[model samples]
Target: MPNPKITTLIITYNEMDYIQKCIDSIDFTDEIIVVDSYSTDGTYEYLLHHPKVKVIQNPFENFTSQKSFALKQAKNDWVLFLDADEVVPEKLKLEIKSTIENTDCAAFWFYRKFMFQNKPLNYSGWQTDKNYRLFRKSKAKFSDKKIVHETLVVDGKSGILNEKLIHYCYKNYEDYKSKMLKYGRLKAKEDFYKENYFNYLVYILKPAWKFFNHYILRLGILDGKKGLIICYLNALGVLERYKELKRLEKKNELAYHLVMP
Candidate 1:
């Protein structure tokens, strides 16, 4: 058979729960490259047994660095980046295949359909989410931001795929809180170094606005309990960011004075 035109790339870190489904969805690709962050879980073992997959073990660093490493390791000219908790729907798989074979666009953004507790969340401000996952390897690279929510920067023309990629973002409340705390800390560090500050008005207004925007304006209410939960958690994430930022600022100031004095 002729060589496959696309390479599927994924990065994993203790993603045992979703790794199997993620791998199964992209079996159509010519090549699959998984760069794992030394998962203590059985993720590495599972990938090793998969015949179509090539696994690379690297130490955990930042999202962009890990994804860029995977991008470089891809053998095919076209690359599709998928998270371990995300799967390409069968319809999306066919759409992507057709796009790759027929179109000359360098990149295509896939609409993501997020699920919470196995429920399809039609609102919660998540319906508008789109990601540039399918791209020509030569035309794009991930930004070297030291954060978990980094994005790919593509150099050529890009288009959108109508089909949705299923994204299982959070399984439960505890999982949500755990990620929020970790992400809040990283965001706080970035803001503190950039001399960003939060005032009383912003501290109160930001979270409120976030809830209003996601739940009310974005029609998240239609999604029922899942929408409310997501909106509440999103606001909490914003609040935690401000709290962590202030804490980091105070710590940095104390360290600076002690070292100079």
Candidate 2:
């Protein structure tokens, strides 16, 4: 039987460090469609010469929208969505090729193994990570509500894949902090726009709960220093997000009063 053709879709921003490796990992695929956000870090320039890769620039508004646009650009029935910081290992590649040729379901979910600070983490909420990234083009659509965490809604039956998708999540504290700040602000804006009420008590208690949940309840302590840092930083991110949300609310309120009352 002939190998089934698949279009790999990727949404990227300033991802120069991981873009090349991410594209190279799926070299066996038929076509790669990348929707970049006018990367100032030379990510777009580096991918310009690749023959099999088609790249386009769109101002990134949110994850769901950017991904939806990329999905439309896909030229094949079977499509795979990958992040610039992720790679499909050889084993997973073989499985993907074989599965696509004989897929019984419309979509497949694969477990993701995350690498943080150059170390692969086995616990602390990373072990349970899974996402539906491979699907029939017509069967998948990202949820309409764009937020910090957007999920894909599959129209038909979904199956699980045996192999794991390797994710290079963060190389160090600086990488983690950059994403933390960016995502924090985005999430705060989403929450504010959604009219989610903010409670002072909840704000004070939430981060503490998050730290405990990750560090102790989730066995983050077992992973050593990296785990502790990860858990703590995540907690900090939650706190910072709420703080940003509060700031936005205050600024809007002041503007309204100054203009009218």
How does each model score on TM-score?
0.92, 0.95
Candidate 2 runs further than 4 Å off: 258-261
Residue pairs with clashing backbones, model 2: none
lDDT tens string, model 2, 98-156? 88888779999999988885588877767788988899988888887766567888888
Stretches of candidate 1 above 4 Å error?
1-4
Candidate whose TM-score is highest:
2
- What lDDT tens digits, residue by residue, belong to model 1 across residues 1-261? 353489999999888988998999999898999999888889999998899999999886667778888888988899999999999889998898877877778899989989887878898898789988899999998776546577778887899999999999878898777777777677767677677886768878988999999999998899888888888888888888888887877887899999994
TM-score, model 2 to reference: 0.95
The residue pairs that clash in candidate 1, if any, are none
lDDT of 1: 0.86
